[model samples]
Each structure stands twice: as structure tokens, then as C-alpha cells.
Target: MKACISRWASEPFRVFFPLGMLAAIAGVMMWPLLYTGKLGFYPGEAHSRVMIEGFMGAFVIGFLGTAFPRLTGNASWSCGELVWMILLWATTVASALNGQVLVADTVFATLLLLLSSGMIGRWACGNRDTPPPGFVMALAGILGGALAAGLLAWNQKYPLGFTSYQFAKLWLNQGFLLLPLMGIAPYLLPRFFGMESGHSFHDSPTPPPGWWPRFTASVICALLIAAGFALEAFGWSLVGHVLRATVILAWFASETPVFRRGKLSCTPGNVARFAVVALILGTAAAGLWPLARVGSLHLFFAAGLGLAVLAVATRVVLGHGGRHDLLVGRIVWLRIAAGLLVLAAATRMTSDFVPAVRVSHHIYAAWIWAAGGSVWLIFVSRYLGRGEEEPS
Candidate 1:
């Protein structure tokens, strides 16, 4: 038992990713009841908090915990560090389930703080090799997560106007999360497609030759988006999003050959490429028509963030285990789940235009989303831990 636990601790994703997926399914499953007042608590708040901080947040932690040390060429996490995080995360999930918002938020904030500190400490204590630009962006995301957590805790404790929490939420999802997603995509996608050139998980890619300019621009665009939030300038933020989207679109186009070279069909990476396109269109639509902001944004969440997380999680679990064949061969249900997610996004967006059917559409969308999440929990849950790597 001790040996197994220690091994599991080494690959944090083994513990967190499946937990995140289950949380995602449960959150969506319950949304309709909450929205319709069949349940007493605030469904929107609880659901959003769980899906963002719990579901997606878990993957972020697992991936970063597993990858950060490697990126910095530092020592892997100590046993104590992994155990502590596991306890804290488990407590957070329990707290959220029991409607202990204050407890959940507080615990989550502490977790983010600890994670950020650990990442920074690793960089500070490691060898003198210059870290990649992606590492820096990841750190920025961790900082943003910390700020978002603090805002949530404050709002729960002091009852400040919603703006602070709202801004924090926006910062967490749009600015912070986007940075790492964009930064890591350049590295992760080629591996997903099994490209002959570029980086593979086994062989870390050389940092892009023109790293500084690209990193700086990404930072500037992210900052502008945050500034728009601070000033409540939706249009300005949309401009930043558009610029970001354009860059991502270009990157996708440039990498088409690499994608084409891969043997996998409907692999997570390929699905995520479509997700990126959805994100671009969603941002554009939200910017163009203020009335459709909420609806339009779901396109990014469901298709972009939602599918992207699944893809990355699938790739990480399979790739690290040296079972890349499963991704293309037996994972047909994964493709179906991805399609359902796109449908869910479309259904939810259409609801905004059809007010008469909005309530029904929302429920339908929720069910579709839940079903999509359920597919992963049923199929991939066992594999998450099977790939745990021994400490280097």
C-alpha cells in the first residue's frame, strides 16, 4: 500500500484528472434542477465554481504538478507535497458538495497559493538553465488563479458587490487559463498528432527561436484583456480576444501538415483544433453582438475549453503510459463525446436567440454536457492511474 500510494503521488494526474471529470459530470447533471428551483441552493454559482475550479482546475493542477518540475529541470515534488495537495483537494470537493462555499473557497485559495509558491520555489532553487516562455506563462496563470481564489473568499466572507468576484472569475477563465492553454498548445499538439517533427512528450522541443517577441505579445494581449475587465470595457477586451484568436488561428493553419501526418483520426488533438476555431468564432460573435455575450461565450467553454481539457487529459494519460494506439483505435466513444459537446454548445447558444424555448434548451444542453462528461468517467477513469511514472 505504501509503495502504491507513493507511486500514485508521483503522478498527480492519476488522482486529480478523474476526480475532475466526475465533478464535471455531477455539476452538469445537477444544473437543471438548480436552475428550475427544484433544488434550494444557487445552482449557477455552485455549478460554475465546481466546473471551473473543481473540474478544469483539477486538470490544471495535475498537469502543472506533473509537468512544472520537468519544464524547469528541477526536482520532482516531495512525498509530503503531493500528500498535502491530495488531502486539500479532497477536502475542497467535500466542502463544495456539502454547500460549504466559504470552506471550499478558502481551501481552494490556499491550494493555489501553495501551488504558486511551490512552482516559484522550484524555479528559484533549480539549476541556472533559463526556463522556457511557456513556464513563465504558466506561472502567470497560477498567480491569476491565486487572485481569483482570494476574490472568491472575500466575496463569500464580506459580501462585497459582485463586481470583484465577477472580475476575478473573468480573470481566472479568460486571462489566466488562456495563457497556459496557448503556451502549452505549441508543445502538446504535435505529440497528440504524433508528428515526426517538432516536440514529442519523450523529447522536449527546443523553445521557439523567436520566443521573446511571441511571449511578450501574448503577455501584452493578456494584460489588455485584464485591463478591459478592470475598466469594464467589454469591447476592449473583445479586441484583445480577437487578436489572441487570430494568433491561435494562424498557429493552427501553420501546423496543419503536422496534424495531417498523424495516424490518429478524431484524436483529442484534432477535436481540439476544431475547438480552437469555436473559440475564435465565439469570441468574435460575443464581441460583435453584446446581447449574445453569455450565449456566445459558451461556445468557447463547451467546444474550446471543454474539449481541450478532455483532449489534453486523454493524451497525457495515454501518452505517459506508452499506449498511444488506444487514442486512435478503441476510443470511438471519445469522438462521440466530443461531438455531443459541440452539440451542447450549439444548443445552449441557440437558446439565447429563441427565448420561447430557452428553458427547455438549457436543460437539454445540460443533459448533453453531462452525458459527454460521463463518457470519459466511464471509459478513461481506470487509465488515469495506470500510467504513473516512477520518480526520476
Candidate 2:
């Protein structure tokens, strides 16, 4: 028992946790949107989103624990922090899932508040190599906690002085989840195409193939996303438009090095190439702005999240695992899987936009999401076995 506990306390467990969380996220995404006709579960939209929120909290904890050492030259965080953080996350997830259990829900929400605040406070001492845009982003975790608190209010006749439409709903949605993700996400963006990562696979800071100015451009992309999401939440819709446009440009700019180097045909290389195209098309859709309607958001997700993020996560995992010394093997199919996810998202998007498509939304969403989830799982396994070439 002691031996098992000791083994579990180490890095492999840490790695596996995020994989599990990501899988859960994919499952939550794919889960059927059924209805009991009850106010809460009728469309089941909130249920899925809340579950995704749980996965996000897990990702944040895992990300911070994994990345902080690389960035700050600190020792990996102690086991105690992991226990506390994960427990808090679990509680928060439970609270969201079972809002009727008022005591459990309230306790869990408070735990999230405490844990998230502690995370920001601990990282308060961190100094940045770049301008540290992620710092403010990370601080938004406290806001997420507040959102969790808002969720708990469903039990108390909704009498917390925060109405669902007002402070409880929209602000919490944007402030808590989207904003802090902005910080850690910059570190995460490059992985989709087997690029440089802090994942301990590639020797430290060695630039990936097919790129000259990937680093600078990646920073710009991250900043654009941060500003876009933040301004959108703050109700500065025009500013959101400008920031999103900047993201489109930055996305294209980041890929210039890849296109120039011309390895653009290899499996992983092609994924990055395709991602750039997706972004370009996505940006054109964005040109429609509010006139663009929800269909445009689907295009954005399909292109940006599905194509780009899929490439980033898989590629980063591969590079960090050290799988591509001569060349990273055929991971392009994974991107295809991601594209399938986009296809699924696009279906729902079409339904949202065109009344004719609404009837098939649930079934369409599930299949595409399953494909995306499966491919990501494949990457996780591939990296675990043979991905890491050298320890940094």
C-alpha cells in the first residue's frame, strides 16, 4: 500500500490526471443533450457546460503544477498542493452537478473560492520573462469561484442578490473560466503541431521545425485571444471585434515560419498548415461580426479550436515526448479527427443559425466529438510510450 501510494505521488500520475481530465472534457462535450422537460435539464445545455467547467478547473490545476517548474525554475509542486487542489476541484464539480444538495453545493463552491484564491496568491511572486499577460488571466480564477457561488444560488430560491441574467450568469461565465484560460493558454497553443513545449520531451527551448518567428507570433496570438475574451466579457463588443481580428492576423502570422520552412507536407507539419487555413477562413467569417450570427462562432470553433487547438495539443505532446527526432510520425490523422470535431461543431452551429438544421443537433454533435476525443487519446498513449526523447 505504501509502495503504491509512493508511486502514485510522482510525475506519471500527474501526467495521467490531465489525460483523464481531457478525456472527461471530451465526454462532457459529446454527452447527449436529452431532456426531462424540467427547467434544468430540458435542453441540457447548462449540464454539459458545467461539466466542461469541471474539466477546465482540473486542467488549470494540472497546467499550473506542470508548467510552473519549467517557467520559474522551481521544484515541482509538493504532493499536498495536488491533494488540496484536486479535492477542491472535485467538490466544485459535485456542487455544479448536484445543486439541490445545498450543503454540499455551498461547501464545494466555497472550497473552489479558497483554492483558486490560494493559487493566485502563491503565484503572486512569479516574475515574467515576457510582459506576463498571464498573471491577470490567472487571477480571474477568483472570478470563476464566484461563478460557482452563483450556481449554488439555484437552491436558495435564487436570492443571493445576484440574478441569473445579471451578475450570476454572464459575468461568471466570462470572468471565471474564459479569462484565466487566457494566461495558461499561450503556453499551451504551440502543441497542436509538435512544436516547442515545456513538456520535458524536447530539450529545453529548441524551436520546432518549419518556423522562424513562431515564438513572437505565438505571443501575439495569445495576447489577441486574451484581449478578445476579456473585452467581450466586459461588454466592449467593438473592442472584442478588433481583438478577434487581431487574433486572425496573428494566427496567420504565426504560421509564416512554418510555411517558409516548407516541411509543410509531413503529417504533423500538414496539421499546422491546415490550421492556418482554418483560421483564415474563420477570420473571414468573423468579418461578419454580430451580423455573422451563431454560425460564425461555429466556424471559429471548427477552425480555431478544432483545427488549431487539436494540432497544438497533439503536436506539443509529441514534441515534448521526443517522438520526432528525424521527423515526427504521422499525427496528421489526429488533426483530421479534430477537423471532424469542427465538422460536428459546424453542424450544431448550422442548426443554431438555420432553423432547418435544428432537428439533428444532438446526434451530429456526438459523433464528431467522439472522433476528436479518440484521436486525442491516441496522442496521449503514443507520447507516454515513446514520445519523450530526452529529459530537459
Candidate 3:
């Protein structure tokens, strides 16, 4: 048991990815339980909290914890750090499950602080390579998450004014996830599409001459994204949405091979492309149909960010496990999972637009999302610790 855990600790993703998937399952399951009268509370806030802070947050921790150390040539997360982080994550999930939003958010803030401190510590003092320039946005996203959590916890104790509340929600729902996804995509997605990423690390201790300029660009983009969120919070929804979407599209086009035809078009890469489309469309839809904003945002949450995270997680697991063959091919299970998520997003949107069928559609969407998460988890979990070992 000790040896098995040591191996898992060596690669944080081996543990946290599965935990994130399970949190996603649990988060979506709340709706079904509520509509069926199995749950006593409405679970709206709790569901959102769990999905963002518990589900998405776990992936952030896993991927960054696993990748950051290597990126900076620092040590991997110690076993103690891994254990404490997992415990805190589990507590946050449990608190959210019990409808303790304040508790959940507070715990989640602490977790983010812990994660940020470790990564920042490595970046500041460690030897070897610098992280990608886009990581400036990634760091901003992490800090945004912590701030969002703190705001939420405070709101639970004292009512934030309507604008303040909206700002908090926007930061939590869109800013935290969107920033990190865009930040990481430039550095990671090119590889998925069989294109060379220009952000590769060098052997020299000092960063290359042009690194700071790229970092400055990332900082400017991050500020633009935050400004967009502020605009939305101040009731300029359409302007904000358009600005955010345009910034993301422009950044993606500049930083990634998103517009170019890559040599490869595999499952993860294809899904990632779909995610980008969904993200832009969904953001625009939220502005275009304010009355159905809830449903439109599902496209961003369930299909856009959710699918993107799974796709990246899939590639990470397969690549690390030496299952290069799987990465190049269309994995049938992943296709099914992606299809299910799309359906769930559509169903959720339909529920918002058509009031008569809202309850039933909500239940259906929840179950569909849960089913999709299960399919993804089942497929990826098999390769977790199997590194380079052929399946029997």
C-alpha cells in the first residue's frame, strides 16, 4: 500500500484527475436528486460551487502540480503536500454536498493559496527553465479563483450588493476557468494537433531574450479579460461578452495553430476544437439571449470548459502512460462521452427556453451529464497507474 501510494504521489494527476471526474459526477447528480425529491434543498449554489471549485479546481491542481515542477526544473509535490491537498479538496466537496457553500468556498480558497504558493515559490527561486509566457494568465486565473472564493464566503455572511454579487459570479463561473484554459492552450494544444509549440524550455538557466515580451503580452490579455468581466458585472453584458470572446479568439489564433491545418486531428484535438467553438458561441449566446442566460451558459460550462478539461486530461494520461497509439486514433468511448455532454448542454438550454418542460429537461440534462462524466472517468481511470505497461 505504501509503495502504491508513493508511485501515485510521484504523479499528482494520477490521483487528482479521477477525483475531479468524481466531483463532476457528484455535482451534476445534485439536480436529479433535487427534482426527484431525494434532496431537500434547491442545490443551485452548491451545485455550481462543487462543479467549479471541486471539479474544475481539482484538474487545475493536478495538471499544474504535475507540470509546474517539471516546467521549472523543481521537485515534484511531496507526498505530504499531495495528501494535504487531497484532504482539503475532499473536505470542500463534502461541504458543498451538504450545501455548506461558505465552508466549501473557504476551504477551496485555502487550497488555491497552497497551490499558488508552491508554484510561485518554484518560479521565483528554483533553477532551470521558465514557464510559458501564457502562464501569466494562468497565475491570474488562480488568484481570481481564490478571490472569487473569498467573495462567495463573504457574501454568505453579509449580502453583497447586486452588482457585487454579479461580479463574484462572473469571476467564478467564467473568468477563473476561461483564463486558465486560454493561458494553457497556447503552450499545450499545439502538441495535441501535431504542431510545434514555440514555447519549449531551454537548457540555459536564464530565459531567452524574447521571453519577457511574450510575458508582457500575456499580462495585457489577462487584464483585458478581467476588464471584460468587470464590464459584464456593471451591466454591459453584450459588450463584455463580445470583448471577452474577441480577445480569446484573437489570442488563440495568434498563439495556437487553431486556424492552421495541423498534420493530426485526433480525438483530444478534435474535442478541443469543439470546445473553443462552444466557448465563443456560448459567451455570445449569454449576451444575445439574456433571458435564457442560464441555458446559454451551460454551453460554456458543460460543453466548453468541461469537455476541454476532459480532453486535456485524456491526452495527459495517455501520453504519460505511453499509450501514444490511443492519442492518434479516435477513441470510441471519448466520442460517446463528448456526444453525451453536447446533448446535456442542449437539453439544459432547452429547459431554460421552454418553461413547460423545464423540470423534466433539467433532470434529463443532469443525468446525461453524469452519464458522460462516468464514461470519461471509466476510460481514463484504466490508464492511471499503468504507465508504459501494455494492457493484458
Candidate 4:
């Protein structure tokens, strides 16, 4: 038991990926329970909090905790740090489950602080390499999350006005997740498509000349996205959404081959493309049709960020488990899971637009999302503990 725990600690994803999926399942199940009268209170805020802070938060921490050390040539997370993170994360989920939104957000803020402090320490001392230029967005993301979490906690105590509340939500949901995804994609996604990433981590103390241009562009995009959020908070919803979508599209066009042919032929690549499209479409739809903001954002949440997380997690698991052969070919389970997520997103949107079947479709969408998460977990859990030296 001691040895097993130690081994799992060596790679944070081994523990947190599974935890993330479970949180996702728990989050979606809230709706069903509420409709069936099993739950006493409305689950709107709790559900969103759990899905975003608990589900997505777990994956972010797991990925960064594992990858950050490698990117900077620093030591992996200490056992103490891992223990504290898990405790805090688990507490956040539990508090959210009990509808203690303030408590959950406060704990989540602490977790982000801990994570950021470790990464900053690595960057400031005893690091042999610099992370890619795009990681500036990642830094922005964590700081944004911490700020949003703090605001949310404060709002629970002393109600924030409508604009302030919406601003916090925007920061927590879109800004926190989207920034990191866009930042990391340029550095990581190429590897999934069997192409060399130009921003791959190296042991150089200083970045190459070519790195600065991309770095400046990423910083600019990140700022624009934040400004867009501010615009939305100030009631310029349409302008904000359009600006965000345009910036996202332009950034991807410049940094990735997302719009190009031949690169996204593989299952993971296709899913990656779908994720980006969902994000752009969702952002635009929320602006063009403000009445359907709830449904439109699901495309960004359930399909965009959710599927991207699964695709990247799958690659990480397979690669680290010595199953590189499976990374390219049509992995039937992953394809099915991705299809289900798309279906869920559509079903959820339909619930918002078609009032006749709103309740039923909302429940159906939740179940579909849960089903997709289960499928992913069932397949990927197989690779979690396998030694990297093991044969495929």
C-alpha cells in the first residue's frame, strides 16, 4: 500500500485524472437528482461550481503539476504539496456538493495560490529551462482564477451587483479555462498530430529569438480577451463576444494548423479541431443570441473545454504508458466518447431553444454527458498505472 501510494504520487495525473472524471460525473448527476426530487435545493450554482472548479480544476492541476516541473527542469511536486492539493481539491468538491459555494471557492483560491507559488519558485530558482512563450497565458489564467475565486467568495458574503457577479463568472469560466487551453495548445497539440512542436521544452536558460515574437503576440491576445470580458461585464455583450471569438480565431490561425487540412486527420486531431470550433462558435452564439446564453455556453464548456481535456488526457496516458502506437490510429472508444459529448452539447442547446422539451432535454443532456465521461474513464483508466517501460 505504501509503495503504491508513493508510485501514484510520482505522477499527479495518475490520481487526479480519475478524480476529475468522478467530479464531472457528480456534477452532471446533480440535475437528474434535482428533477427527480432526490435533491432538496436547486443545483444551478453548485453544478456550475463543481463542474468548473472541481472537474476542470483537477485536470489543470494534474497536468501542470506533472508538466511544469518537466518544462522548467525542476523537481516534481513534493509529497507534502500533493497531499495538501488533494485535500484542498477534495474539500472544494465536497463543499460544492453541499452547496457551500463560498467555502468551495475559498478553498479553490487557496489551491491556485499553492500551485502558482510552486511554479513561480521553479521559474525563479533552480530551473534549467524556460517554458514556452505561450505559457504567459497560463500564468494569466491562474492569476485570473485566483482573482475570480476571491471575488466569488466575497460575493457570497456581500452580494455583488449583477455586473460584478457576471464578470466574476466570466473570468472563472471562460477566461480561466480558455486562456490556458489556447496557451498550451501551441506547445502541446502538435505532438498529438505527430508533428514536432516548435515550442517544445529545452534546457536553454534563455529562449531563442523566434520565441519573443510569439510571446508578445500571446500576451497581446490574452489582454484582449480580458478586455473583452470587461466589455461583456459592462453590458457590451455582443461586442465582447465578437472580439473574443475573433481573437481566438486569429490566434489559432497564426499559431496552429487548426484550419489547415492534412494535420487533423487523426482521432485526437479531429477532436482538437472540434474543440476549437466549439469554443469560437459558442462565444459568438452567446453574443448573437443573448437569449440562449445558457445553452450556447455549454458548447464552450461541455464540448469545447471538456473534450479538449479528455483528448489531451488520453494522449498523456497513452504516451506515458508506453502505448504510443494507440495515439495515432482510430481509437474507437475515444471517438464514441467525443461523439457523445457533441450530442450532449446539441441536446443541451436544444433544451434552451425548444421550450416544449426543455426539462426533458436538459435531463437527457446531463445523462449523455455523464455517459461520455464514463466511457472515457473506463478506457483511459486502464493505462494509468502501467509502467512507461511496459510494452503496448
Candidate 5:
């Protein structure tokens, strides 16, 4: 079994992480989608988040495990990669479909899959890119993230308490996002098309806060998220607010500049660029976090952060896969899933969101989440089956 994982380190792991994140997102959208107000068969929103996050971790670990090495032209996974991917995905899907992520299920979910995936990912993220620091940063971030995930899972020996929720949120926010952004964004930012960063716009060797500051903030953010979950769940709303404020401030301060620094913008001509408005809306929402009512924070996160992810992923797939496809015939999606996400976010924010007299909310959420995922999957399937890597 050890030898098996060692051998097949690269591809399956890489593919799984993003796929898992997609699952978590889907589960969230599925619940609360009933016009009839009947909860979907998916886990309630809270459990759904962690369960899906587990799925995301599964893929990320898999990807980082091998891709890290591959970036430096070092090598690929040793073995057992497929087994890990299948088991994890199967369990996650089962958990999600069940509608309740119990302690036992969470334990099982971590045991047979998430934990193992992290270990493998850590093994793969051994090398660093030579000419640039992007690969190195990504490698380090992924390894750190994997370690964090393992620790979070390990800490889950108890019931689904507040601490576990914080850990779960950290896994998504920090392990899944912060680390990857710290590591890969620099690389992906430039070589977006899987090609050279031709104009030399974002050309850089070191990343933000001179590495140390970035690391400090990332670690702090993780801790704060964990603390916030614990405090909030325990009814310590004041502490939770304080922790969230700190984390959010750090997150924005650290991250917002990266986008601003570069002259390179998301191609306005690129249909993907439409996500910018969504991001702006999200940023605005975040800026107003304390004031907003119930679903506002979610709107910003989904529209700004999550929606941007959809646009970016779809664009990346098209560009990398050599497609360059655009919107769903004509309308916008969550950032864009089905055109429904736009409406969904609006509805979430306003509740009275337009006269959606009949259609269920979950359908819109599912379509939005599934849309980009489906497109990405289609591209991957085609890419894997057809021929060579995307042309350089």
C-alpha cells in the first residue's frame, strides 16, 4: 500500500483536489434549494461545507503530491494513486448524498481518504522550480496545507464540535486556498495559458511580504479561522467577530495587492473577465461584512471568491485545452455556472430576488456549481483520452 501511493503520485492527486472542492460547493448549493422548503438530501449546509471540503482536500493533495515534483521536472508518483483517488471520491460522494456528515462518517471520510491523500501530497511536494519561485512556493504551500489537513483530521476524534468546524473552514480557506494562492497563483498568474509570461508583466522570483510575512499571515489566518469556529460555535460571538475581522483584514491586505500590482488584467475580451464585476461585488460585500444581514457574506464569498474561481477555472481549461469557449449561449452564471447563479446570488442577497415563482433554488445552485465543473471535467476527459499535452 505504501509502495502503491509512492508510485502513482502525480495525475490522480492533481485532478482530485479541485474536483473535491467542487463537490463541497455543490453540496452547499443543493441544501436550502427547495421552493417547497424541503431540505435536499445533501448534508445540511454546515456539515456539507466540511464534507465537501474533504473532497477538495482529496484532489488538492493528489495534485500537489506529484505536480510539485513535476514542476521541477523531478518525477511523478510512485504508485497506488488511482486507489487513493477512487476511495476518497467514492466516500465523499456517498457522504454528500446521505445528507448528514456524522462523526462516524467524518471519521471514515478522513481515515480512508483525506488523511492518506495529504500524506501522499506531502511526499510529492519535495522539489522546487529552479528558474522561478512559483513552483517552489506552490510546493511548500501544498505540503504545509497537507500537513494542516492531516492535523485537522487527527483532531476530529471527538464529536462534530466547534473546533472541528473551524478546522474544516481553515482547511478550505487556508489549506485549500491560501496555500495554493501563495504558491501557485504567482506561477498561474503569468503562465496562465500554460505558456510563458510573454510580456514580463508579473515577472517575479519571490512572493509577497518577502515570504516570511506571507507565511506569518497565512498561519495566522488559519489559526484565527480555527479560533473563530470554536468561539462562534460555543456562543462566543464577540471573540468570533474579533477573530474573523483579523483574518479578513489580513487576507485582504495580503492578497488584494497581488492583483493590483500586475499590469496584466483578465482579458476584457476574454469572456472570463466578466467575473471581475462579481469579484468587485464580493469585495464590496466583504468590506461591509458586519452590516449585512444573513446571506450577504455568502454572496460575496460565492460571487467574489467562488465565482471568480469558476471564471478562472473555465478560462484556464479552455485556454489550456485549446478551446476558448465563453458564456452559456448568453447569460451569466454564479460567476457563471448556469445563468442561474447570477440570479441565485441576487436572491440570496435580497431573498425577494426577482419573481422566481417556481424553479427550485437547488437546481440553480447545482447547475452553477456543476456548469464549470462539468466543463472542466469534459476538458480533462477529452484531454486525457485524445493525445498530447496542450501545445506550448
Candidate 6:
């Protein structure tokens, strides 16, 4: 038992990635149960927390724990770091399950802060190479999430009279999740497309000539997102989100040429690209149609977050396990999963637009969401623990 615990604890991704998927799957499943009056309590806020912070948070933790050391050329995270992560992750999940939002947020904030500190320390001590802009954005996103979590915890304690939950929500949803995505996607998407260094087999993308252009673009993107969120907080919801979504769409539009470069079939690369489009569009939809925000929000979850997680998780599992072929292969099931998620997103969005079909749509969306996660776990989980690249 000790050995088993030690094994999982040492490998952050191995322990957290599957758990994250499970949480996401369970969260989706619960939504339908809530709608059907089958469940006594439906912690909608808690459900969002688990899906976004819990599910994506786990993947982020695992990825950072695995990748940060490599990028910084720093020593692998200590056993102490892994142990703390496990303890905190377990506690946070428990708190979330029990509807202890404050507790979960506080723990998550601490974890983010700790991880950020470690990475910053390593950057300070290690070689003087300028870090990737995407990486910088990601670190900033982590800190931003920490601040949001801290604020949420404070609100719980001090009882800030006004409703600031939306602010916290935006910060986590856009600032924490989107900014880092902007930073990393440029670098990773190219690799996924087999466009890096104009070669397919290279494990990493060839760094762009002079990171300044990408850095400048990243900074602008972050500023636009931040501004949009700020506007939303200040009661300019439509204007703010429209502006934000426009920027995202424009930025993504700029990347369309890359997608056009090759056969745009049902490949993982296209799935990822589609995920980006869905994310931007969903964000815009949420802003434009306020009444349909719930539906649009689920669209973001199912197509945006859900599909992207599937793509990246598969890549990590395969790349790390020395099975890049399977990772990049034209796997039919992967396409089917992506299609199901798209269906889920459509069902969710329509739930708001058409009242008559709401209940049925919710049920459809929930099952489709669960199906997507199930496909991933069945196929991808097997490869996750195969690699011991990260040290124990």
C-alpha cells in the first residue's frame, strides 16, 4: 500500500490526470441528475469549480510538474512538493464534494502559489535563457487564479456585501484558463500540426525566430482578456465579453492559415483547432445572449475545455510513453469523441435557446459529455503511466 501510494504521489500526472477526468465526468453526469430531480442537492457552483478548477487544475498541475523542470533545466520537484500536492488535491476534492467552496478555493490557491513559487525560484536560479512568453503568461495565469481564489476565500470570511462571485468566476475562467492557453497553444499547436521545424517527429516545436513577436502578441492577448473581464465586472457584460471574444476570434483567425496548410480531416490537430474556435465562439455567445449564458457556458465546457483536454492528454500520454505514433495517428475514436463533444455543446447551447427541449437537451449534453470523457479514459489512460520520464 505504501509503495502504491508512493508510486502515484511521485508521478503527478499519473495521479491527477485520471482523477481530473473522473471529476469532469462525474460533474457532467451530476448535471443531468440535478435537472431530473434525482439528486437532493445540486451544487452548481461547486460543479463548475470541480470541472474547471478541479479537472483542468489537475491537468495543469500534472503538466507543470512534468514540464516546468524540463523547460527551466531545474531539478525535478522534490518528494515534498509531490506529497503536498497530493494531500492538497485530495483535501480540495473532498472539500468541493462537501460543498466547502471556501476550503477548496483556499487549498487550490495555496497549491498554485506554491507551484508558482517553485517555478519562479527555478527560473531565477537556472540558466539565463529568456523564458517563453507563453510560459510567462501561464505563470501569470496561475498567480491570477491564486488571487481569485484568495478573494473568494476572503469573501467567504469577511462577507463582502456585494455579489463578487461573477468577478471571481471570470478571473478563473478567462484569466486563469484562457491566458495561459493563448501562450501555450501557439507553440504546441504547431507541433501537433507537424509544422514545427517543418518536421513531424520532433518532440518539441522549434522555437520561433526571436520570441519577441510571440511575446508581444501574448501580452496583447492577455491585456484584452483582462480588460474584457474588468468590463464585465463593472456591469458592462455584453460590451466586455464581446470585446474579449472578438479579440480571441481575431487571434484565432490569424491561425487559420496553419489549419489550411494540411488536410483538414478528422485528426487530433483539427480537433484541437476546432476546440479553440468553439471556445472563442462560446465565449462570444455567452456574452451576446445573456439569457442563454448557462447553455453557452456549458458549450465552453464541453467543446472548449473538454475537447482540448482530450487532445492534450492524449498527446502527453503518448509522447511521454514513446508512442507518438498512436498519439498522432488518425484514431477514429478520437474523432468520434470530438464529434460527441460538439454534439454536447450544441445540445447545451440549444437548451437555452429553446425552452421546450431544455430537459431533454440537458440530458443529451450530459451523457455526451460523459461519453467523451469515457472514450478518453478507455483509450488514453493506458498510456499515462507507461512513461517514467519524470523522476520519482
lDDT of 2: 0.49
**Model 4 agreement with the true structure over 259-358: per-residue lDDT tens digits:** 7764436778788889999989999998998998999999989999988998889988888899888877699999999999999999998888888999
TM-score of 2: 0.64
Predicted candidate 1 versus true structure: per-residue lDDT over 1-392, tens digit per residue: 77767766667888788888888877776668877777777666666667767887788889988887777677777788888887887777667766676777678878888888988887777743445554556677778877887777778758756566667777766656666676567566766665542322232233445566656755664565456566443336556556656655665555333335565554676777777788778767776666877788888788788888888888888777666667664478778888899999999999988889888988999999988988877777666656535221
Compared with the true structure, all predictions reach lDDT values of: 0.72, 0.49, 0.88, 0.88, 0.45, 0.75
Q: lDDT: which is higher, 2 or 3?
A: 3
- Candidate 5, residues 1-392: lDDT per residue as tens digits? 55434433445533554556556555554554544466554344434444334544454455455444554445554455456555655564655455534432454445434444544354445423332333333444444444444554455564355555555544444344434443444344443323343212232223322444445544555555556645655656555655655554455334433333334333311222333345344434443553442345445444444544544444433443455443223323322342334555655555323335324544554445445555445434443321125452
- For candidate 3, the lDDT comes to 0.88
Query: If the candidates were sorted by their TM-score against the true structure, best first, what order would they fall in?
Result: 4, 3, 6, 1, 2, 5
Looking at model 6, the pairs that clash are none
The better-scoring model by TM-score among 1 and 3 is 3
Q: Report how far off residue 100 is in candidate 6 (Å).
A: 1.5
TM-score, each model?
0.85, 0.64, 0.97, 0.97, 0.60, 0.89
What local lDDT score does residue 243 receive in model 6, on the 0 to 100 scale?
91
Candidate 3 to truth, TM: 0.97
Candidate 4: regions farther than 4 A off: none
Ranking by lDDT: 4, 3, 6, 1, 2, 5
Among these predictions, the greatest lDDT belongs to: 4
Q: Which ten residues in a row have the lowest lDDT in candidate 2?
A: 197-206
Model 2 stretches with alpha carbons more than 4 Å out? 1-40, 43-45, 94-239, 251-295, 301-303, 306-309, 319-329, 385-392
TM-score of 6: 0.89
Sliding window of 10 residues with minimal summed lDDT for model 1:
197-206
Backbone clashes for every candidate come to 0, 12, 0, 0, 27, 0
Residues 1-392, model 6: lDDT tens digits: 66655555445677788888888787777777787787667677677777767888888888777777766556767677888987887777778766788898899999889989988887777643445656767887899999988888888878753537667768876578776666666656666766552211222233446565666777777778888888888789899878987887776556333345643333677788788878878888888889898888776767887777777767777778767666555887788888988998898889899999988888888898889778878877777767636432
